[model samples]
Target chain A: MRYFNNPEALLRLVSSMQEGFAITLTIFFATLLFSIPLGMVIALLRMNRHRAVSVPVSLYILVMRGTPLMLQIFAIYFAVPMLTGHNLERMTATILAFSLNYAAYFAEIFRGGIMSIPVGQYEACRVLGMRRSQTFFYVVLPQVFKRVLLPVSNEVITLVKDTSLANVIAVGELFRAAKNEASRTASIEPLFVAGLFYLIMNGLVTLFFNRLTQRMSYYRD
Target chain B: MLEATHIRKSFGDTRVLKDVSLRVSRGEVVAIIGRSGSGKSTLLRCLNDLETVDGGEIRIGGQALVTMQAGQPVYKKDGERRALMLKMGMVFQSYHLFPHCSVLRNLTMPQKLVLGRGDGEAEAKARDLLAKVGLSDKAGAYPCQLSGGQCQRVAIARALCMDPDILCFDEPTSALDPQLTQEVLGVIRRLAQEKRTMIVVTHEMRFARDVADRVIYMEDGVVVQDGPAQEVLGDHRSDAIRAFAGE
Candidate 1:
């Protein structure tokens, strides 16, 4: 209470964080909304038996997952567009880096879930005369979703916290705002406030996923 | 009618099926039994092309199934696979009731996807099937929320929704508790009474003897005994079958 002499100061502080919070949320949610699907596709590609299809996909996944996410982020943010000359903006580059990073991780989770399903399910689907695609989508995908939820949720939570890392590329997410506030006001108090903000956002995300789990509890496989 | 001339399959040098073959009429109920690793399940799966037979020719209703082809040989197994699949319903050892969908949706998915039934018609058919299985009250429940028996009943309702001519059960009662098995077995027995064509691979000799019209006994993938359930179960002549039933 003593740290804040007036409500106006608290209001300004919250408002300052809001601009970055929006960026943080955008990076987090957009990465998830896109990456989960992309990751699943990437995972499927890796699992493909044909070397022409699976080899390159497996190499791509290995490169992304094998390296530290931070290093990949820096490489993609700094070097990716230069080779192709896409000239992406800071926020866009940050999002792209985050998306690719999480996609690799989510791909593994998807693969694990797909692999964990009893082979009998596929046999059962094929026995019923389902096409390969139909069997994968109808019989196989539902089970994978049920199994991969927890691992994917963990990656998502990690992504939310990882948004802070985007500040390196001047994306101006939560931690960036805190840094600005700390230096401008010459107070470490604003830094603690931003830390609290991270906890709140992570907590909210955890709650959302918990609710999702309940809705899907009906499907064991 | 179904005719499998010479069905064969092997797994990594460990042969599971060996030149096995049989025939079933349009309304026949064939029960397959064997000791573990005798390829009883493999034979059933091969008949449906679930397992690619290494060497064989299968004909369903006069169609050749070695390639899932069209016309000639009525291989209800090849290009005929999809429609044949629609015409055939399957029950798994672990009741695969499409856990993602509700009971009604589970029943309708095949009708809509495979049978090309309209949503309205599929819904009606699903409801009817659910009623037939005595699960109309649980139509909204997902597989997880239901007991093993209820889930299996839903699985049956789902298969029946497609109006398949042949219903295959792969050890349907193997995974269930004794009480739950009775419920599932009762549904299957009722289907048999309605003159439904069924091919079942099971270890339950009692059910096979009680419900099956014809019984086929296999050893190392070849049929060693084929006759009426009573003859095979009671009049077991082969030492292998006698040994199997401990007679």
Candidate 2:
């Protein structure tokens, strides 16, 4: 509480937390940039008729979803390098782990969205003389995105909090910086400040998704 | 012209179309009427290549869609099938009007993507067709925004924008109430007066009798009777057709 009365200490905490927040933002944005499209590809692979492709994808999804994300971070940061004889930088390991893990969740969400579309859409595209790829990209994906937007927004909001898990690998992101600040200053105020940052980031994400949903409201199911 | 000869199809153990053959010449409006599960819709689907025939042949404008070779049906190649489909258009019972797009886009997208028309040209043609269908005001609306009647009209205009040689409709009015049915059937009646070539599978006896030059009565997966509309619908000889026509 005394830390709140000290202007210099509060300014120091905000400035240091700002640097950590930048890394946190980078992780959040990079994970989304990589995972979303990769999730769509994995969803398509999961939907493939061939057992050889679908079976392995199913297993990958199972492992990713069933295991703890923190454990996955450790395995990627430590075990992967030991097993492969190639070391990944701490931030690289964190991003690789977060992206692949979230992609599994996004893939299932996408599959559900794609499957929810009525069969009539595909028939309409086919009768219109559109090839399969054209139908999927133009006719199907737009509708799928509309239907999946809410669920995807939920996953994306979860991703904001999940970025904190990167701290388990000692990457010195937001939460780790906050923890270090608290220990150094012998005060819990920095932890509360870190929670506020998460709340603000998630609030912005919610507002962004709400705007997207409104723009897409022109067409209903 | 469209010719479907000995078209046979089945779903698992149940046969939907059995040796069904039909011939429709240019500028003819043919209506196939029957009880549900009589394969009327399935025949229309086969013509559009929505369902591959288990055995038989279909030729559109003298181009073979499918032919029998070595005891199996050989369908046209992908490019050939696409080209053949370009010459035909279909409207479904559900209206299937790409619900995510505006009414104008539903008509214009296919023209731009399939026919390679420029965007302005496609939009101009779409506007014209929308006006013809009495929906020029609803061009900015989505299919979900329109009533069942209005959606069907948009669907019709969407199909016609392709400038196809033939148009197919599968129970277009089956999903509509009486007033909405009239709204759709009125559009069909006008198209018929314009001498457009169309093949429609309908449950509306009156629309079939009025708009079609040829009326085909189907029963148990085969064409039981086919003749001029006046002769067949007015002076039908089959018991099934009489019961269905409510005579």
Candidate 3:
């Protein structure tokens, strides 16, 4: 409330979000960069008929999806070293946890996209002499990405907010920065101001997703 | 030329094609006609090795589809199946154009990848094909934007990109509106004029009557009637074909 007492204090609150915003973007961009390919790999693994591939992949998906992201952050931040008997940094643990957690979700999305395509497309590729890799890259994946973008963009927008959760493990991200500023200055107004910050980032991501939808609109059946 | 002997396929316990034998000589356009679920499509797939046969063999351009003469697997090595599929192009009932690529890109990909034709050369050829199919104005459009007939013509143009000797059609006009059906029929007639060897499976009796060199009527996965189009559709012989023609 004291921060809201003056224009300069509010200005301080706005400026304070910069550090948290950067951390937010870090988690946002990093999750997209890492999760897409990893999700595709996991998707392919789940598609595999062999128990060696499917069982473990399904297990990963089960554990990640069955639990909340909050629990996962806690586990990776705490349980990893206990099990592996190794020391780890907090930021690294957050990223590892978030990437894997989202990957399981994105894998199901990718599989749905792949499965949604008509079977004749595969036959078309096969009879056209496209090799497996070529068929996938040229024919299958363009479609998977097209089908997946909306759901993925929704997740990405969600990721922007989810990065705030990293503050639980002391990542010094946007939310953490705001919390630090608020505690130091003895003001709760920074928290409300921080919510406004998340909205802006989410708004920009929504526009980006609109553009993606425009590009993919052609691929719709 | 292509030949198949005792081609058999079954999904689980339900056998689709039982001891199916077919032979196609050079420059022959054989039309296979049948009711729904009569295995007309499966036979075409078997001819092209799109579906693996449980017990039989298909040879296209002197290459076996299921197994080699050595009795090992066919396409045992990488690129073997690709090498064979390149010689023949198949047109599906639903025009399976790559949704992401434009019509120009659709026509160019197979040329560049399968025929090793460069992009510029393929584009020029694609333009010519688009012109040939009366879709020159639609070259910039994607498959989804086109009508079903226009898409089929584009599919034909895309298939022609490879300069294949054999073209296979699976219910080419079944999905089109009546006015659109004539557009595709015109293209098929033109292909006949160009002496393009083709195998078309269709329910359009009039198309089989007008375009086929020889019409083979399939009933219960077997050819019940095989003769010149005039004889086959112009007062056909077998009771099965008679009933199939709704006589």
* lDDT of every predicted structure (CA atoms): 0.81, 0.92, 0.84
Q: Is candidate 1 or candidate 2 better by DockQ?
A: 2
Candidate 1 local lDDT, A168-209, one digit each (tens): 878888889989988888888777888888898889888988
Quote model 2's TM-score.
0.97
Q: Which parts of model 3 are misplaced by more than 4 Å?
A: A83-85, A218-220, B67-78
The residue ranges of model 1 lying beyond 4 angstroms of the native Cα positions read A1-10, A219-221, B67-79, B235-239
Q: What tens digits encode model 2's per-residue C-alpha lDDT throughout A1-221?
A: 74688899788888989988999999999999999999999999999999999999999999999999999999999999899999999999999999999999999999999999899999998888988998998899999989998999999999988989998988889999999999988889999999999999999999999999999998788
Q: Name the weakest run of 10 consecutive residues (lDDT summed) in model 3 chain B.
A: B68-77
Residues A103-212, candidate 3, lDDT per residue (tens digit)? 99899999999999889788877777777788888889888887888888888888888898898888988888888877887877778888988898889999988998
Candidate 3 C-alpha error for residue A189, in Å? 1.1
Runs off by more than 4 Å, candidate 2: A5-7
Model-by-model DockQ, in order:
0.49, 0.84, 0.68
Chain B TM-score per candidate, please. 0.92, 0.97, 0.94
Q: What is the lDDT of candidate 2?
A: 0.92
Query: Per-residue alpha-carbon lDDT of model 1 for B161-200, expressed as tens digits?
Result: 7677788888988888999999988988999998889999
Please give the RMSD of candidate 2 to the true structure: 1.4
Q: Could you tell me which 10 consecutive residues in candidate 2 chain B have the lowest summed lDDT?
A: B232-241
Residue-by-residue lDDT tens digits, candidate 2, B8-67: 999999999999999999999999989999999989998998898999998999999999
Which candidate tops lDDT?
2
Model 3 steric clash total: 1
Error of 1 at B238 (Å): 4.6
